[model samples]
Target: MAELKEARVPDIGDDKDVPVIELLVQPGDTVKKDQGLVTLESDKATMEVPAPFDGIVRELKVKIGDELSEGSVVALIEPAAAAPAGDAKPVAPPPQPSPASGGGSEVAAKAAIPATPAPATAAPTAAVVETPTRSPPVAFDADALMPGKVPHASPAVRLFARELGVDLAQLSGSARAGRITKEDVQAFVKAALAGGGAPRASGGGGGLDLIPWPKVDFAKFGAIESKPLSRIQKLSGANLARNWAMIPHVTQHDDADITEMEAFRKKGEENKDTKVTPLVFLIKAVVAALKKYPNFNASLDGDNLVLKQYFHIGIAVDTPDGLVVPVIRDADRKGLLELAKELGEISAKARDKKLSSADMQGGCFSISSLGGIGGTGFTPIINAPEVAILGVSRSAMKPVWNGKEFAPRLVLPMSLSYDHRVIDGAAAARFTAYLAQVLGDLRRLLL
Candidate 1:
């Protein structure tokens, strides 16, 4: 007798209610262990749920486009019966053809068919065998073809194809096993318009050719107009509002003179292969300062304050959609060059939407730099749970008093925003001052 078992969804990290995107199997299908059963898409990443054991799928409890949480029953499977005693592993039966094809009966009946007798007329002309005339191959029509069984492509590719009014079904996919690739879609769109099959429009070209100009009726809503927010946008808005309302934010401002640091960096760095950045110097300074003041490298946990011995700093990266913070683990231990390299790599990944949830979590402190955007000073919002955040602003040539006369020197503005509930105003100011001193000295960064 075979035992029935329920296949429950596995723990997909920290995300609880992940949405189910697709179902790979159906009822009564034989599945092997470790085979992908369903795809769960969270805000961070998409993960596949695999079969727990080798068995025949008896029933599927859920369908595609369903939202699933942890411990949700995905399917029911019946275990294959155990082989008797010392018998070898049971072999799977061969697949049967459709009943319309007459499967086993057609094969047996073919042998009993009598041969056709030749007619005896005027020497019978050697009984010419005529082959049936083949019909012309069907022209590729966009409406006639059905959607391919290949997995869906990225949303950007799909949107591009839609905007061009290019029917994906008409194009021959050149990806692995005929999957539709982004390059393939782009090439197809270019070729199709070039061939005069469709009219092409310039970037800002007027008339109906551009995006087919959607019809608008102004009389429908003359008084008011509103639109709903997307899921991601809605979540971001809520998070931002919560952070502003709940956290008691306090901002501290200071300036760093990079005169000695700039001179030191320019000394032998011209001939060296490795190029150094100001951000790298600042990161080293922040890590070193964290050692002296561990409270600055801490987070607020519930009513209790959690002080983290490990130094993980999150670098804020601004993308087209929204802001993302990718954490750099063990910043205190990493060298200046290593820290710069990791920061560049993680920031690029975050901008490209390739960062996982793990990369965003466990950040003890955060640094948001707007200096590159020509901002002299701006107070950055504190990333939630983190007690403090550092903001780097633009460096400018400002007048400084020398022993005899005033001279021009470069000055960098820095801002520190802290959770006032946990960190005092004086502590924030002192921390900012220390950071400014480190940036000014530069040699202490090496220590």
Candidate 2:
């Protein structure tokens, strides 16, 4: 007699009442041991609960959006007594939040580490690519895969891709008959990161299968003329979209007291040959902070972090055509006066549309200053191949508690946006504090 087994949620650490984003099987489906039964998403990560033993799913107790806790019954299954010997071996508990690579927490646009092996489903579908060269191979009936047909995927794979924000249509399926599988999506992300490109986003573009953009005449409401996007707009638009979609960005806002630094800049007004600006001072301060936090001067190359020893800072310049970032190479080596002079020259070249592509390359970090234009604060998108960017807003006078009394201080609003994959909240907060501290005390530059 076949024994009935209940597939239950395993011990997913501290993530109580996690939401189920996907259901991998339906009632009456014959499932194999260790097959993923559902995908649960907590605040930190997306996890899949797998079957405990080989069995037939007699009933499913949960649905999408249902909250689940550890040891919760997932589905009732009638265990197969004559199952293969391979199925009898005790299944290793799924990998935990690893100290080495928090593979458990990293999912979606920025996670570089390989996600825990999303268990395979018993359904006849696309073959899943195995990870670590040691996980069990995806096994089931061969007819589950049909060549020269539509790409095949289990329900689990679809949910996995959705969590990662990957457009399944854009990927070249790695399984037979061009089927898209969980492993395929993971591999696609790895390839995209290695190429310094992001997996195309779904909806309004590729994945998600969204509705086509409406092609209605606006003239019906009022007279209007269609203008083609400028060359720079067309180019920058695509890059901006890609960056926004792929990177998990978090912005940390702070205020830097540049009261002393401003006084120093005005003194240079007498020298017509070299006019110093607050931006020059900012560039220097930023370089000093980058030296303290080397990770800020690094890019995620595949699974590896590429840390550059040299500093090449990019300053965002608003030009007539569009926004352009001109690189200030060897910013660390340049003094405040030299940086100010170089800044003036490069900015002029940018506005004149004379900057070569090389002039914009090799930036380890970027600064987008809107001080002159005016803004309290803004989140700046990260320039990829670089992990972070600093947004500088207009400085204004604010009252500060001087321990003895309140004093009017010139405060510059600063926003630091970083890729959450490479930087955590605590580190970002510390970086912002350090930057503000340096800007507040110009003497720190001497160190």
Q: Name the best candidate (by TM-score).
A: 2
**In candidate 2, which residue pairs clash?**
5-77, 202-207
Quality of model 1 by C-alpha lDDT: 0.69
Assess the local accuracy of residue 86 in candidate 1 as a C-alpha lDDT between 0 and 100. Answer: 18
lDDT of candidates 1 onward, in order: 0.69, 0.76
Per-model TM-score on C-alpha atoms: 0.48, 0.67
* Per-residue alpha-carbon lDDT of candidate 1 for residues 206-317, written as tens digits (9 for 90 to 100): 2113345467786686876666765446756766665765678889999998877777777747746556667778888888878878878777665676778898888888
> Lowest-lDDT window of 10 residues in candidate 1?
82-91
In candidate 1, how many Å is residue 321 off? Answer: 1.7
